[model samples]
Target: MEDRKKDHIDLAFSSRLNGDMVDNRFDYEPMLGIHGKKDLSFEFADKIMQLPIWVSSMTGGTKRAGTINKNLAQACGEFGLGMGLGSCRILLDSPEYFDDFNVRPIMGDDVPLFANIGICQLEQMLQNRSEGELDELVDKLQADGLAIHINPMQEAFQPEGDVLKTPPIELLKKYLEKTDLKIIVKEVGQGFGKESLRQLLALPLEAIEFGALGGTNFSLVELNRSEAVAAEVYNPFIHIGHTADNMTHTINQLVDKMGYKIKVNNVIISGGISSLLDGYYLTEISKMPAIFGMGSAFLRHSMGSYDKLQSYVEKLANGLQLANNFLRVKL
Candidate 1:
């Protein structure tokens, strides 16, 4: 106790925080709650996740992906978190990389595991009347559902990107008519605008993940892969989009105004959620059932040993529990 006090005294001067550094989003109520684990479990996509954390999709179809996915799935199983796999597009044409994305055995059947695919690929499948391939892919992986990521900006920037013959909204409206699979629509980085959100909310989607701006901008990724001149021309496009907080508030207002019209009842608050507090704040303020997801954060830890990934997820769970116990949103 004496040593702790001495260390606190020594660190006090350097630890002083000012106005801008203060997180004004929450009221830190020390008197109302205890510093102990609170039940954070919630039903999402018809499955229960012990922690409100989703390991956002990162990579697959590579030699290293098998290791990374195994590590991530093991962590999810141990921690009771949901996960979305990186694009399963490659698996549609060939089964050569199946093992890389085959983590259901490691992840178990309890928590939710989603298979991801791009909007363009789905559009092609629907056109070709090969949507059954999607079913086969999901069935083989034993994923709970499908997450369709829409990124026109990213596609436009890629040198060999697929050209969209029909608008994404139209394609989605058409595709929903055929599939019984629970669908989750998400942005790759550039989030949905108000109209886009409204349209999506009107659909019978399982969830809409805010793969908002302030995270990995796939448009920027494509630009970086392009020629220098082309990159410069399209650089400004990457900066356009909404952040997670902005989308959360927008959705809340939309829900207030168009209550019954909103069909999608759940959301995964992701993109630019840098820490547990960010996740807690957004999920608290959201009008719908929401959980937060992290991609780069989980990817970083998953690249190492399984122990490393487990430790990282443990910290996330611990921090989130502490936040839920004492912190309340200021709104």
Candidate 2:
């Protein structure tokens, strides 16, 4: 037993956190009694999430897409968390792949479920005056709203890419006029800069999801699948744009500067967030109604059985509750 203890101590020494991680994030207080998970509650997307985390969109119309979507929806319904479906582009043309995206029935009516579509598709709909198709997409999904994901970087590297014809924000202005569905504008990866955020915040967006640089930048995803020469040339673009923390801080300051001019009051702080502590820190510092989102992290467990996702969410909720009780975000 002593030998086992010595081996464990050696392993712990190798994995110990460095001094660089030290900061005034949480004030240690031993006197307060430990709290239970029941104490934590998060209200977002017009419903309360049992946990303060979100199952951000991923895997649509791909292999085992139906299974992935169903599993994610079940977890969302069970945990009281919100979800967004990946690009509904496949469902736009036919009902053949509709089962892959039709997860609203599983996520239920209480927790918010938003249908997603790329900016390229939205541009096409606008140019053609084909907004009816989008309206139908939402109706069929029984989703609360639509999230227009802007992905210039991803599209740039994607083969046979639909090169954007018009400026996205301008197209968004036109798109909003065409449909009354609730909207949240998000980046695909390589998050918005100050000017972009400023432009978006000035509009009547329901929320902003920072598909920031530190996360799985879809630019890199597309590049990896591109020709070797093209991938090498475009690789540097992946590092561009803001982090979740940067975006959150800029949002707070910009809102303060813009005040009433800012039409947005909700945001999904996502990208590169690997833990409940990260979510709590960003959510706590946010100036508006906020919910932290994760793509790969949620996707990792979501691809498996329902129990896997459920257990992951249970830990996140409990962790969030503990953080909320003992830690405070330093403004």
The number of the candidate with the highest TM-score is 1
Best by lDDT: 1
In the range 92-138, model 1's lDDT, one tens digit per residue, is 87789999999999989899999999999999999999988888888
lDDT of 2 by residue, 1-331 (tens): 9999999988996888977887676665556636854445566556676776677888677668788889999888988888988888888776788888888788888788889999999888887888789888899899888898999888989997888999999999988777788898898778999999999998888888998878888888899999999988988888888999899899998988998898875899988888778878888888877889988888888777889888988787777767766665666
Report the C-alpha displacement of residue 218, candidate 2, in angstroms: 0.6
- Clashing residue pairs, candidate 2? none
- Model 1 error, position 24 (Å): 0.6
For candidate 2, the lDDT comes to 0.84
RMSD of each: 1.3, 2.6
Q: TM-score of every model?
A: 0.97, 0.92
Consecutive 10-residue window with the lowest summed lDDT within model 1: 57-66
Pairs of colliding residues, candidate 1: none
> Where is model 2 poorest over a 10-residue stretch in terms of lDDT?
36-45
Residue 127, candidate 1: C-alpha displacement in angstroms: 1.2
